[model samples]
Target: MRLETRDLAWSDTWRAARLLAHAYRDGTIWAAAGTVAGWRKQASLTLLYLAELLICRWEKGFALGAVRGDRLDGVMISYEHGERPTPWWGWLLRSFSCLFAGPVAVARCVRISNDLERLKPTEPHVWYAVLGRRDDSPGVGYALLRAGQARADALGLPGYLETSAGEEQVRINELLGWTLRDEYVLRTGAVVRTMWRDCPVKVAS
Candidate 1:
């Protein structure tokens, strides 16, 4: 299906969140937290994703959407250099809120958050933070990735992303020219791989 890309609108937030929640429902750290939390899983994750979308918007980051004739089939959220970090109060609030997801889940969240912080690149770069697509959507995920990477290239910034060490994910990153920079295992025992892609350089003819 022909997919068109555009900046995600305010009206797309909730729907985007729902799609993300489902997309990550079985594999991500947040999904692991939800699994431990049991009944509060859905609420906790939905809220977390909602918060992320808000932060992405506030940071003036790239929140791109892949739409098929008005239906948002895929979404990607990324932050360029110079964007403000998530406020202390926002982190506090999110932490406190995760308490309802139970102690184990909370601890997992803290550990994963810390690990991500420690792994973040110090140089100016673009962070490819979140990407999601509906189950029925095909090629939309790749479209989102290409769009985000093009923006990063335009800004003359390298791109960074972390994903599960699954074979498919690793293959996809390789296909997109992202190099495997590092690999680590989370406290939850999930293996994660950090990938980097250098910005395309223009040589004067």
Candidate 2:
């Protein structure tokens, strides 16, 4: 399968959102709270992702896509040191947008955010906010990971990401050189793992 990586355009936001909604439909923290199914839930998830895309764009962060031919099969959203911890207004907007998923889902999302914050790295790093691949796509996830890591290396910054995908993602991160920093159980009972990857130290010849 031919895979091409590029910066995601504003026009591609909805398409990427749909891909993430379906890709995480059964396994993400959203799914654990029943917010990954149904039309309302899907719509809310799409809006949430769209908000994230816009936030990343505003921060001059990376919102990348891995396309297989004309289809966007994978997405990776990340922000460098000074760009993360999205501003208050962004969170407020995200929470408001998620209202359509119902109170329970919104509350769970908030709690998950809190949990992630508690586990975040104390030092400056690139935050990999979201990484996902289409259901039928294979290997694209790793490609997306590499794309984010490449940016982190270029900036000479460590990388951080929290995953609710459990062991599978943990193993992938490990294979990609990330170390497990911590794991916590969210209020919704989903276990999230935070991983870290130090930047490659350049050595003198």
Candidate 3:
């Protein structure tokens, strides 16, 4: 059955977080923050996903979910450039939730977010922040990505994202029309690739 994709309701936060945690648990890029924060496997990812979802929601970032019957099959979290300005207090409130992981976690998260933002292209574009799906859902991730691409196309801007999801994911993004822009290797030996896809539906000049 084809899963439906739409904006996930905040009411479904727990379920959505759990699905994201499970989907990216084995991914090295996904586990980096937790490693620095001292969170173990499942617990770390679950908390990370929860923190991200909450922060993204509070900051007006986009959350697209793929659903099958009663559960979410995948999620694509993104942020469009200059969508809505996030207030200072709003950031504090959203970030406070991550304290459950400890102060180190929070500090590292801040550093990482700042580092990635610095690396992003200055051109106006959509940031494909987080993309993951259930292990059994073969195409849910790509489907949600295509949806993101469509949004970028409508905006007449490119889409940009960084991935530490490994080389396999790099290849997949290439197939989806994302070109490798740069790469950074972390101290923990993880490689994060910065990628960009030109407007997917450009009109002929």
Which lDDT values do the candidates have, in the order given? 0.79, 0.80, 0.75
lDDT by residue for model 2 over 35-149, one digit each (tens)?
4447777777777787888788888899999997788999988988935657787887687567778888777767877767877877888999888898788888789889888
> Residue-wise lDDT of candidate 1 within 164-187, one digit each (tens)?
838787898889989888777765
TM-score of each: 0.88, 0.89, 0.81
**Residue 169 lDDT (model 3):** 79
Residue 194's C-alpha lDDT in candidate 2?
A: 83
lDDT tens digits, residue span 75-174, model 3: 9888887343556654564554455545665566677767776788887888888888888888897789988888778878788988887788788989
lDDT of 3 at 86: 55
Question: Once superposed on the true structure, which residue ranges of model 2 sit more than 4 Å away at CA?
Answer: 34-37, 85-96, 187-189, 202-205
Q: Rank the candidates by lDDT, best first.
A: 2, 1, 3
TM-score winner? 2
- TM-score for candidate 3, residues paired by index: 0.81
lDDT (Cα, 0-100) at 93 in candidate 2: 67
Candidate 2's TM-score reads 0.89
Alpha carbon lDDT of residue 55, candidate 1? 83
